[model samples]
Target: MEAGGKMMGMQLSWIRNPQVSAMLLLAAAILGLVIANTGLGPGLDALKHAHLPFTVFGLDLSAAHWVTDGLLVVFFFVVAVELRYEFTQGDLNSVSKAAVPTIAALGGVALPAIIYFNVAGADGAQGWPIPTATDIAFALGVLALFGRRLPTTVRALLLALAVIDDLIGIFFIAVFFTESVSLPHLGLAAVGIVAFWMLGRIYRGKRGSWPLRIALLAVALITWWLVAMSGIHATIAGVLLGLVLSPAPAESARERLEPFTNGIVLPLFAFTSASVIIPQVPLSELSPVFWAIVIALPVGKLFGVTIAGLVGQAALRVPKPDRMKLSELIGIALLAGIGFTVALLMNELAHRSAEDLIVEGTLGVLAGSLISAVLGAVYIALLSRRYPAVDSTERTARDSEEYLRRTDSE
Candidate 1:
């Protein structure tokens, strides 16, 4: 048990290492691209659709579906935990703290959808949700690369916005993408959720309670299966379970699972989702779906987030010290365009039936996110030069200490 505990600790530490996680995601994506374009493409494609021999509760799915529908739950679970933390104790603990980002996130979602709708027109309009997501890991990873010159507030704002954006994406997945509903299965999932919640309350802080842990895991898996059967995305199961778990256990679970989600789950999902054949069609001949996503992500996100943030700051009469500067808001907006993970997931969910559109959509996400990253990095670098690095360092340390105090008190 001690050895297991130590191993888990090391794994948790690795998950906390942002640079490593980002590099893993990037490397996986590059490898997927390379493999998809090579002679191995057909074999990889076959493997993706290859079904397992066993079925769970009469449900059999392909390997790719298993990865997306099953393993991605872990990623969403971690995200839900982070969302809960932010809402309860972090930057989004209060309305004032949340207003700007929430409004910005809404704008971020709305405008990109509108842009996609207008650009793609009626025929290709189904993919409006494609550009509405912001990949927190990729965005933060880029911010980290630029060093400490940027204000801690920038990171805080980006995190808040990204979290809200994720909440919206989850809503879209649950509502828009669901093909049908099974009330009986949904009720079963609800029962599992309630049991999970009850177990959490009873087992909270009971370290080394292996039986309780096993029970909770069983309930979570059952909940996921039920939700999947109900025609809702299985990832919703992760969100529900994460939200219901007692705070202490939720944090512990997140810590334990983060490494696997970051290092394996996310990277594998990226690899599989990105393994699309590059279209041979000329750029001009590409469908509007391609251009819509390509344009909406970087351009739409920047316009939406910046405009909404500015309007929200004005409307809310946010204090000057708390208000984000125009340059900072622009930088955050640009970063919001790096919609990698969730964007890819949305693409798959949105264009599952249309193979040609899927290829185009994947390419668009990659292109748009890359453009956003490059532009956001340069903008932030220039913005950072205007601020004194010493001040940034002091502010960051103070913020960290404050955060620790809050956590301990909570």
Candidate 2:
């Protein structure tokens, strides 16, 4: 019974409800905007500015510090969890499965930064991560628009690219966005890191079930708090917790958790973070920063990923991508340029130093994410008729299930 429980939990952890996730994400963002702009913004701003008690057993500070330095740790933990899972059992674990997308993700990340930096420059260039993320919700939502016409390969490629892009975005956050370090806390972080790994081993050795994961949540929260205080970005905590307890190892555990993470947790996070006020920044007087973001994110992302994917195939003799047209492929690449959640987080983190610049970056993300979604949708809808991606794996899984049933009947 214990073993069965474990397996069931694992299955639950890995469901991919992309449609629901995308819609909820968009709704959340829209809701956030509505709330923030409709008189709630002032309250939020006041709350953010309001000084709350930050008593840490002995050391005390303000509330905003806690939010920035503390609460956001949960977000970071999720990011770590996703990163580690991908590196271990997810799309990134297999080279062949990961190759094309990784290459595309790399190009997508590099060129946008280059373009953003050149046009926007290093002064405000710290905001580059804003334009880096490929909001999976937005991209996938666009794919749904094409429905039956879209190639399966294009969808697969887009997802892979987004994951790899997410990985890169994390590294950027860790390296670039961080503030002056505290060496003592950093060392302590190393100690806590070892402890987390040890915990993972213990749970795996026990062949942990859902209860075990639930039990570990308290520890993970504690671990995240410790690391957040230790000067590391707190959001890394979320990713770590996810990866550590990732039921993906056990098929059943993946079933329950994947759906929640994809359909609920991820969407909630997107909505919470994306609700920025589109305050009247007059279009007639838009900044060059805006135009740079406009050109750099969409144009740069499409050209960069498309060209890199082509070059990789041509130079390395990589296998030709199956069932996706050059046009549809490029379209998918464009959609992958939509940057939102990560950008907003970064903007909030970096705003003190570069407020004006961050606004432009934010605008760029909105424009790029929106444009990529629309254009990619139209382009794929037109070409999807010719290149329908036959999902061989899906077919094989169904076939195997049918064969097993027949064997059982016999």
Candidate 3:
């Protein structure tokens, strides 16, 4: 029994590890792609396209939709909680702390979009949002795997930047992708979201109160359903609830839900999204949407982030000790291109009407993200050689001491 318990604990630890989770996500995508090109492709495609038998609050969706719309909402909730934490108590708590990264993030968004529009043309305008995302898990995974010698400041900057980039992607989904909004359903969802916020605040200190937790969960589901029926993306509901929930309970929810998201929700979505048959055409014959994403993601992100970060630093006249060097900023910018998860989702939403574009866009996202991951890994590894390794435990201790010292002085 003890041995079994230990194994279970190890499994949970692995699920919670960002590096391991990112590797698993990549593996799942590769597996799906491989299987999709094989003889078993039909079966896998059938499974993904198969609609579930029942409808919940008028949501009758396919297996793939269930992952994207349902399970992925939980992932967004965790993201939103982390975002709120950053804005309140973490790296983005103040203007001075947030300005450079926020500017860099905006650059990351704008350049890729401009490149996509230029490449794909006006008819392909809807697909411009595809390359604007930065997958937080994949970006963090690459950093954790290869950035051990890198300063904590770099990690914090990357985290803040990715969070902000996702916020933009969420905005695109809410504003651009939403077609027709049902005011009645949206009004109800707003009320439910408010109630959710109130419940979280009331139960903020009551960690053991299962009854209230269950009630919160019920309200959350109802809000999600209402948002879905209201013609807005259901994931917006998660974002709303996460933003409004009291900090104490929000943090608690993030911790508890991380494993479920990392271990199951993400990998499943990756597999389903990446399960597209590769287009059998020559590169020249491929749609411009494919080439646009492939180019915009890595190249645009690299230049966009580096330029914006340097400009922000220069304009602010940041001190030498506090500002990152150009080389280090470039490395982080490379990682900003790793927009696998959200990029795939955006590709689906953008090209859903055109079957051919959807397949091409999927390939584009996978290929683009893979290129970013490889480039980021190689650059960061070489970069790590310039800096001596720092133990995370020791760093944590030093940070704690510094915090206490600052608090005493204040």
TM per candidate comes to: 0.94, 0.79, 0.93
Model 1 lDDT, residue 354, Cα: 89
Which candidate model has the greater TM-score, 1 or 2?
Answer: 1
Q: Write the per-residue lDDT of candidate 1 for residues 1-410, one digit (tens) a residue.
A: 42475456554564656667777888888899889999999999999999878887878989999998999999999999889989988899998899989999999999999999999999888899999999998898888766358777889999999999999999999998999999999999999999999998977657558898899899999899999999998999998898888886786677578878888998999899888889887999999999999999999999999999999999999989878999999999999999989999999899999888888999999999999999998988888889776565775577456534533432
Total backbone collisions for each predicted model: 0, 41, 0
lDDT of each candidate versus the true structure: 0.88, 0.62, 0.88
Tens-digit lDDT track of model 3 for 230-310 = 998888888998999887667666656788899889999999999999978899998889999999999989999999999
Predicted structure 1, TM vs. truth? 0.94
Name the runs in model 3 displaced over 4 angstroms.
1-11, 392-410
List ranges where model 2 is wrong by over 4 Å.
1-16, 54-91, 148-151, 208-215, 240-272, 279-281, 320-324, 387-410
Model 2 Cα lDDT, one tens digit per residue, 114-223: 88778766566666666666776567766765644554566767877877787777677677767766677656655655655565566665653555666555566566
lDDT of 2: 0.62
